[model samples]
Target: MSDALSKPRSTPGTEPKPPRPVPHSPADDIPDGAQVLLAVIGIASAIALLVWGIPKGYHWARAQDWHHFTQWAATIDRPVHTYLAAHTTGLPITAASAYVLWQGIGLGSLALSWATGATGARLTWIAYGAATAWMVWDSSPATGRPVATALAALAWTVGSAFALRGLSLRPVIVNR
Candidate 1:
């Protein structure tokens, strides 16, 4: 038989060949615009909450409108409470304590998101996810607005996750 024919054919029946390591390309490694978009979404959402949400909350509080305040609080607090209640039951804790804990977590995540790196992206995902959950659960008169905000937050979370995963796959060359 000819050498070509005699040579052992590397076919499906034979042991599979080891995958060749692909040479890393800087272009291939770099993150796309999605990361920036996600980061921007996170920042804008946080700013909105701090600017509009906080003031609204304060207004409700100052007015001594317990009903409105509870509704507002539920919008911001209920999701976190629900998450905590589901995940960490049996722990002796008051609603105030839970709120504090959730706030701490949100703040920490936000801080990390501001810092440059993969941690920032991961933090953005977590912070946005929590915020989205909160908005969805809270019973607010501005229900339509919260729905839109929650959807935006969810988009940010998913986008950030994709960006972070992409970054992990290869070194991203970000333009300063």
Candidate 2:
């Protein structure tokens, strides 16, 4: 027999090499347009809340008498922060410094969630829209513009529902 024909292709103890893993591409990390839009809305909403909504809310909370919700929030906060007096009521913060801290933490979290494609930021924004709509509905009689309020609430609710469907939980990879 010829030398080529006489030799075996492989030894019994040898094993075949495994296939290589596919390389990751930057394109794979790009989110869909709707997702990006939702992220933008969340970021904008968070900024708006920090800039305007929180200040207004803080003032309102201060002016109002102790409600059940405020009582509950205070009860929960009291244990966590003993420095807050028992009488210190209204949505867990009685001082101007608290608003600053709240704004800083809220903005940082929203930014992180947006950057990471976390479901939390989207969900929180959707909740805010829904809550705003509910509040509009509740106060419509006083506004004396029931039709406009109804329409606004409808838009807010529907928009938030659609956005909820677009929420994503993946960690976004930035393409440098």
Against the true structure, whose lDDT is highest?
1
Which candidate number has the best TM-score? Answer: 1
Model 1 gets an lDDT of 0.62
Per-residue lDDT over 71-109 for candidate 2, one digit per residue giving the tens place of the 0 to 100 score: 544432332233322224665667455534544553554
**C-alpha lDDT of residue 78 in model 2:** 34
Q: Model 1 over residues 1-176: C-alpha lDDT tens digits?
A: 78898877776767877999999986675588866887899999999999999999998878784786566545545555555566556778865687676566555554455454556556565655656565455533455656644654655465555444435556779998
Superposed on all Cα atoms, model 1 deviates from the true structure by an RMSD in Å of 16.5
TM-scores of all predicted structures: 0.33, 0.30
What lDDT does candidate 2 reach at residue 25?
A: 87
- Alpha-carbon deviation at 88 in model 1, angstroms: 5.9
* Candidate 1 stretches greater than 4 Å from native: 1-74, 78-89, 116-176
**TM-score for candidate 1:** 0.33
